[model samples]
Target: MRNHTAINTFILLGLTDDPQLQILTFVFLFIAYLLSITGNMTIILLIFVDSHLKTAMYYFLQNFSFLEISYTSSCIPRYLYSLSTGDRTITYSACLSQLYFIYVFAITQFFLLTVMSYDRYVAICKPLHYVTIMNRRVCRRLVIGCWMVTLLLMLPLFILLLGLEFCNSNAIDHFGCDAHPLMKISCSDTWLLQQMVVICSVLIFILTLVCVVLSYVYIIRTILRFPSAQQRKKAFSTCSSHMIVLSISYGSCIFIYIKPSAKDDVATNKGIILLNTSICPMLNPFIYSLRNKQVKQAFTDLVTKLYSSQGTREILK
Candidate 1:
């Protein structure tokens, strides 16, 4: 890995320059970040402690929650610190590290979502074989495979980024260190890097999207053939939370990366990135918990147990 870059630090031109707007943005982001951490952590805790959640579906949900926390943390805290301290300079190594983790977590999320869709497919379409197909060993392997694939895919691009020479400009237009923004400021011939990025992104996007679509196609077909209306509703309900999450995730990423005009719209891209990193992570736990009866039941039971334990301790005192 060659570090040929002359620039050691890059200045992030954050969301806004106005003091009032920065304050407002800071407050909003702080709240969102706090809620996102709390919510995703709660889900992880619930899955860990609740016996009722010891299933393949909940197993994947737990991993997904962890990813959400990691993904948001990878960039949001740095930006918050920058906003609060008026320190926008990030070291080159730190910026590259952030860029790597952000991509890893984000890309892994897409693969995980695709895995989740397959889990649902097996559960709904092949109910009799669901347990055998998505056993503990298989689920664990799937999660690990997602991480491995992401790392392998990102390694080349990251290596290329490491060799980039930034001579003219050090200003990143976005709040966080993103691939495109970094490339935008590089003095190196970025034609290869850009092509590699496009190829990797399109490959990941299309492959996962095709899997998700095929899974759902089979799932919908199976649901429709169910004889009873209640059965169809029940089947659809089980997958509803996953479907919603998939839509939000893929939709935001598509808008930002896949759209023909997205690269030219830097301001709009930043807005979308804020929403994707902060708001979406914050909303996911609520979406699942609200829609999932099993998770709700588990939460109620946990609360009741904790309350009872506290009361007993008071009586003993």
Candidate 2:
């Protein structure tokens, strides 16, 4: 009896077959890993130290920065290790765990973005109710809810993948563990679970998309009604950052899931997933941190204090 798709583990092909390319890929990913970790960590450290950043917005942002770092670390570093060593094997349990965490981070991030957008809407569109609506209690609960919902939604992918028996092929084409790409290799009919994936994807997408759109819609309307040029500029500046992130984030997700099938464009689909995982996390800190006056000031003051203290230590020495 031949094993058709009974793969206990998978050999991740990584980026390229060429030896030179493997080295290049490793170098590039290693640098990416470093920058992503360093950049996200700096935000977390600054947010932690600066009392100025203790507000609801930065709190959500802190969670986001942490998630970004985790998301990339889960996929890229493991892929880098496999590519560099040429031993592409991933244990069955490892692959499942990877899949679960990927969804946890990704789905949670989307919901978190949605929550952030709603927070902005309250702050901008309804200033009177801003504090009342987005109180510390509410924000904390909502953030926690995002994490919970993402974990619950991601369970189905594991359930489906686990039940299926792989006959022979155990190679995952991409650099890391991906649910869809890995599913494509199974001998069993995955159509039953495609609906689950679609439903989860749509629920996540629709909720986030709707909230983001409605927030912006009101935000735009409110900005238009304002007579002061300063107010208009402030509104536009604040909203634009959220808009940029929402567009890119949802666009990648919807583009990938809405496709007729995941098998249609394995490389391109993985590329888009990579984009969502790679660029979005790094972009959040830059977009959210730099644009807001409070975060910027906190960042500046923290750096200034650190350097100033260092100088004082040298003088004292």
Candidate 3:
């Protein structure tokens, strides 16, 4: 066994350990990285520049863009670098920082989604009082609360990880320093950290899922009373996007960490990791854009304007 002090960097066993697949993996993830950045950045810019999008929906859209970018950026760059250079090694400090921020961004996303659900709930169920209920002050406070609370949640997890002694194991059997995969590297008995992770995971699951379920329940109950068919259709369309996003993200996260036992075998757990870190980010952009007509129009408008302006500039030149 290697000495505890000898462990300084970790060799990541990325998506596939097979060197033959590195180029293909790099190409695939690079495409995902491009789409995720471009789509989310466009959403953020749209929310910023579009005067019509100054409402609560767009405010939360901005937050989601920020979260998605931070979350995806935390891992994808490293994964892509590893794929391209065929260097999967990460220094101890770098890995620790990556792990910390991954959890931080994830926690932020959980609360942000919950806030979005509450926003939808108010907009739908309490339409008459929506403006007053979701006032500027209230919305700002809720957004701040989500960020602060997520930071708080990340503190204990980072401390717990720091205390662990990595005596021998240096291979992380995943693309990133995912909680479950990182835990496997601890040579010290990880019963306590695992338990802490389980409790934290459970809290996010229960808290966020309960909020979403309650919000949707209220929204649906109110929708049932809508007299107009168009109104009902609009309500369903609005909630469908949130429901799909919440389900997929939470589903992948739970599958990876909830069972605890399943996390031990990296080979089997690879699918779960892929969904949470890679697939979920990519899906968020397309899922949201495809389902929302306004966004589709906005995207088309952006593209058309771009090409039109280019042609004009060329003619003038």
* Per-model TM-score on C-alpha atoms: 0.97, 0.92, 0.92
Residue 200, candidate 3: Cα error in Å is: 1.1
Query: What ranges in model 3 sit over 4 Å off?
Result: 1-6, 260-265
Clashes in candidate 2: how many? 9
On a 0 to 1 TM-score scale, where does candidate 1 land against the true structure?
0.97
In the range 1-317, model 2's lDDT, one tens digit per residue, is: 33423456778876568898778767766776777788789889888999877777778878888988989888887887787667899987888788778878888888999898888888888988877888889889999999888777777767787776677578778877776766777777889787787787788788778888887788788889999999999878877777787888887777877766545576677667766777677677777677778778887898899999999999999
Choose the strongest candidate by TM-score. Answer: 1
* lDDT of candidate 3 over 1-317, digit per residue (tens): 54445688888887676777777767777888788888888888776766666778778877888889899899889888888887889998898889888888888998999999999999999889988988878889999999999888878877888776776678988788866767777777778888888788788879988999999899999998999999999989987888898888887777666765543466667756655666677778788789988777777777888899999999999
Pull out the clashing pairs in model 2: 3-167, 4-168, 5-166, 5-167, 5-168, 6-166, 6-167, 6-168, 7-166
Score candidate 2 by TM-score against the native: 0.92
lDDT of 1 by residue, 93-145 (tens): 99999999999999999999999999999999889998899999999999999
Candidate 2 vs 3: which has more lDDT:
3
Which parts of model 2 have CA positions greater than 4 angstroms off? 1-6, 260-264
> Which has the higher TM-score value, candidate number 1 or candidate number 3?
1
Report lDDT (Cα) of residue 140, candidate 1: 100
| Model 3 pairs whose backbones collide | none
